[model samples]
Structures are given as structure tokens and as C-alpha cells.
Target: MLQRGVRAMRVLRASSVGLTRPAASRSLAPNAARFSSSRSRFPAPLVASPLLQRAGLFAAAAASTSAACAFCSSSNVAMSPVAEAAVAEKAAGQQPTVVLYQYEPCPYCCKVKAVLDYLNIPYEVVEVNPLTKKETQAFTSYRKVPVCRIDDEVVVDSSAIISRLRELVVAPTTASNEDEAALAEEEQWRQWVDQKLIILTPPNIYRSVPEALQAFDYCLTEGKFTPMERRLSKYAGAVVMYLIAKRSKKKYGIEDERQSLYSALDSWVAAVGDDRAFLGGAEPNMADLSVFGVLRAMHGLDTYEDMMRETAIEPWFSRMTAKVGSSSRTASN
Candidate 1:
């Protein structure tokens, strides 16, 4: 069934790229909300899944990952037996139980979510606080958002998660899987998402004081914090991001920051070219999801709107949004 676009966006499983978040070590004030400083961000708190974890005040269904792919990092972590089993099951035509550990408004998490939802893969969510990831410490040493425990196996990094997931269900079992060149090409684009595209977001979204506050205001509500902490995290957080965004603009060599962002979008659509519905052809590939996921984090802001209006990304974006969203809604029904 075909469907029109609904609302949603993605990034960060907290990329080194997005606004610098508050220190996870900051202590809460005395006499806070019903939430003790030592309390856990439990899911019973009414989230999308039994496994969903959120840090701080409210438990959210969304999760985040670093904007960079797993390949971009050097992680010595071993694959979990549970993840291995899940992959085996998926390859064998069985559904694997996926537990996604994440926080909302994270682009990388959104990327994984989009892929999972687009593939119609069934999974549960665990929302861990971005500041303090108390919910899933037992599962991972890295302790980041968008950490997915596929059965017993734990996968970190959006690119790794997507690549690993494709190993089971996405890539064809036939000769097509043997195309190393095609796989390499796909990987190149995924890298572009992390190194190039995600870098544009921080400067664009937190470009001004007003924009910074607006972004944080929404985050504070979704964030885990006492009333006092909420105020601190809101105002102070906005100011910090506003400053950091400027530095980021300079680091990425974005002279007219907004234009740099717009140009990147244009380049992305051009890479997709005219014949394909997505970079992956008929459906979203890892590249498509990464691009969409990162941008999703800035959905309600000027950056998202300007990019949508100023670039050729809309048709493809709409196609992906409608297709994935329709499938998800249908599955829910």
C-alpha cells in the first residue's frame, strides 16, 4: 500500500559531530524531582517497547548513534553470541528479536530505525539517557545511544548495525552478494554520510542563540533532568551548543555555513542521479538511511526546511518517508 509522508527524523548514536552535550558527570542538585539522582531510566515509563530505555526524566522510544560508521572507528569489541544467532536466524528465514538501545532526536539511531522499519524488521526499543546510559551498561562497554542488542549479540555504530543487518536479510544470498566492488561503493557513500553530511548539521541547527535554545527546549523535555537541571540544561545547554556550532563551522571549512549545508544536499541528490528512487535503487540502502537519519535530527528547524526547499532531495525524501512510514503503519495495524 502506498502512503503519504507523516512526521519523523534521525542522527547520533551523539556523534562527535553534533552539539557537544553536557558532561555525563555533572551532579544533580539536592531535593530534585521524584526521580532520585541514582534512579534508573526504566521503560515501564510507557515507551514503545519493553526494552526501550531513556536517560533522565521521560523514557523515549528513539535512540541515537555516532554519525560515523563503525568502519570509521577502531572497536575491538567482539560480536555477541546473541547477535550471531539472530543473524543466523534471519538468514534461515526466521525473525530475530531486536532490542534497540537508544535516545530520541539522535540521527544515527534514526538511521537504524529507518532501516529496520523500512525492512519491516520487528524489534523492541530501549531508551537510555544520553547523559548517563544506566539502562544498558551490562550489555556494552561503549555505552552509546542506538546500541542494538540483536538477541544476545550487541551491535554499535549505525553503519555497523546496518551492514550487519544486511548480512542477514538485505544482501542477496546469490551471486549478487559476491559483488565486492558494489559493496565497496555502497560503503563509500555511507562514509560520506558520517564525515561529510553529519558535520553540516551542528552549525546549521545551532547557528544562532535562538536556534540553539529552540533545539534544546525540545531536548530538555525529552531529556532526563530535575526541574532545576532542566533549566540549566536548557539555557546553558543552548549557549554551549551555539558556541560549539561556530567552531564546527570553521573546522569543516564552511565559509557560508548554510550554503555549505545546501550544497552538500545538492551533491547527495546528484549522486543518487535521476534513474533511481534512492541511492540504493528501488529501496533505501545504508547510504540513503544515513543521509535521511542525520537530517531527521534537525526536522523542525530552519536547516531542514531550507535544505528541503533549496535542494532536489524532496522527491527522494518523500518517497522514502512515504514508503517506510506506510509499511510501519501497516505493520502496526
Candidate 2:
């Protein structure tokens, strides 16, 4: 029973928040171009951000909208046939409704949401502060936020969610050869962001015993620390994590790892290039979304602001913020 409980605790810790950072902010330049170039020809549909998708907010909203429409009579029909069909496509599970669970100010959560918005996938957002909500207690079992529910399926982690989304959405193949190559490159970058870039978090954020203890205290006082533990126990656990990061740093050298992380970010931005607006060529693709999730951490932390500003990823950050800011305004209305 003790062992089982321990495993459950680990899972809970993993699911309560997103795994990426604010430093690697996503770009919407490509998406902006796509919309602008096609505005006269083909207007784009509303895109959902990762937070909305993971929290099941979009699905919930769609369900509400459909319910509202059910009250209309045939003689009072309002929606055009095409509009109705599009609604049905979303309602019938033709497109996945992503429900994201997250807390405000979490850089990782922001990163994931940026991707969702870039892709224009319809999603819902559920705001959850693990410290304050009992419902968030359920997350203690899984351990991460940016958890996604597609249809009835539950995906607990960001990388897993990305992989699943790629499988569901078919990439456009009719674009120019250059665009096709860009799409493939973007996909590869997405995988690296999830698998390789994510590993840098422990070293960067939890590098010392005091830092880990402070984090644990914050989590506890903030109400996120679990198991209803005494102060000492929580502090002890924080120390353990601190020790692990410290040891890892000693072996890997924190500065070297930081440099490598920056290099990866540089490579990712260079791949997008100035000519294109987005990583997925003209449309925001999985690559943009994936990278955006990690970059969020950098943006959230004041300490890294200068480093982020100095990098090639800065303009891309502006583009993504603009896109999300606009979407947020629309959603509020």
C-alpha cells in the first residue's frame, strides 16, 4: 500500500503542471501570413490554444452551442448548410476537442496553449490551481497539467498529446516543394523539443537545495503540496529534488547545459527563418506549437528575459503573443 501510494504521488506531481518553459516562446508569423494571404480567398476558422484543448473547454463550449441550437425549429433555422456541416464535423468527433487543465502564470502551460492557438484547433480551457482546488486533487494522481481529453481519451503529458495530435491531423501536401520540406523539418523539431529540450528543466530550475526547498515551501503555502504532509516532510522532499538536480549539474555542468539549451533554441528559430512567418511554412503546424510550449518557461521567468531578448527567438515571441492576445479577446466576447 505504501509503495502504491508513492507511485500515485509521483504521478500526481507529474500531472499538476505543464512540463515546458516560458523561455522558448512560439511564433505566429507563419500563421499571420497564411491568414493575410488567404483572407480574400479563404478565411481561416477559429483556432484553439493548447490550454483550451487540454482543459476540454472548447468541447464544453461546443456542446453548449449545440444545445442552444437544438431549441430552434426548422422554420427558424438560422445556420447555413455549410456552417451547419462544419458545426457537425466538430460535434461528431471529426475533430478532437482538447481540454486543458492548468494554472495561471505557469510558463509550461502557456507554451502548450500557444501551440494549440497556432494550429487553430478548437479547444477548451479549465483554470486550475492545484494548491487551492480540491478538484485539482485528481491531478495528483497523474502529476502534470496541460493534460488533454480528446473525446473521452485522457492524455496526461504534453509530448504524448502532441504525438496524438499529429497522428490525427493530416499535414497539407499540395503546397510548394519548399513548403513540404519545411513541414517535415517542423515535425522533426517538434519531436526534439518534446524529448530533448524538456530534459533541461531540472538542471535549470531546480539546481540547488535552497531553491528546491523554496519551491516546496511555495507549493505548500500556495496549497499545491500534496499528501497533507507536515512542513518538515515537504521540506525534506524538496531537498531530495534539490540534491538530484545538484548532482546532475555537477555531472553535466549547469553552464554547459544552459549553453546547449540556448543553442537548441537558436537552431529552432533559425530553421523558421525570416522569410517565412511560421515554422510550418504558411500555416502554424505541430512544430510551432511544440516549441512554443517550451519557450513559455523562459518568458515566465524574469531571470531569463535578457537571454531570451538576445536570442533570435525574440521576434517570434512577439508574433505568438499577438496571435494569442487576439484569440483571447475573441474568446472573451
Report the C-alpha lDDT of model 1 over 1-333, residue by residue, as the tens digit. Answer: 001000011112222233332111111121111110110111111122223342321112112222221101212233444545455556654455667766555667777777666666666665554434556667554534566666556666555576555645534433354345555666788768777887777788788988877776654565444666556545644554465566557756788878888888888889889998877666665667768777876778877888888878889888878755532211110
Per-residue lDDT, model 1, residue 275, is 94
lDDT of 2 by residue, 196-283 (tens): 5655554554556554444444343433334453254345444434444454456445566557667777887888888887775545
- The 10 consecutive residues of candidate 1 with the worst lDDT sum are 1-10
Distance from true position, residue 146, model 1, in Å? 2.0
Candidate 2 lDDT (Cα, 0 to 1) = 0.45
lDDT of 1 at 189: 83
Give me candidate 2's TM-score against the actual structure: 0.55
How big is the positional error of residue 249 in model 2, measured in Å on the Cα after superposition? Answer: 3.1
Model 1: CA > 4 A from native: 1-82, 138-141, 176-184, 223-233, 326-333
**Weakest lDDT window of 10 consecutive positions for candidate 2:** 67-76
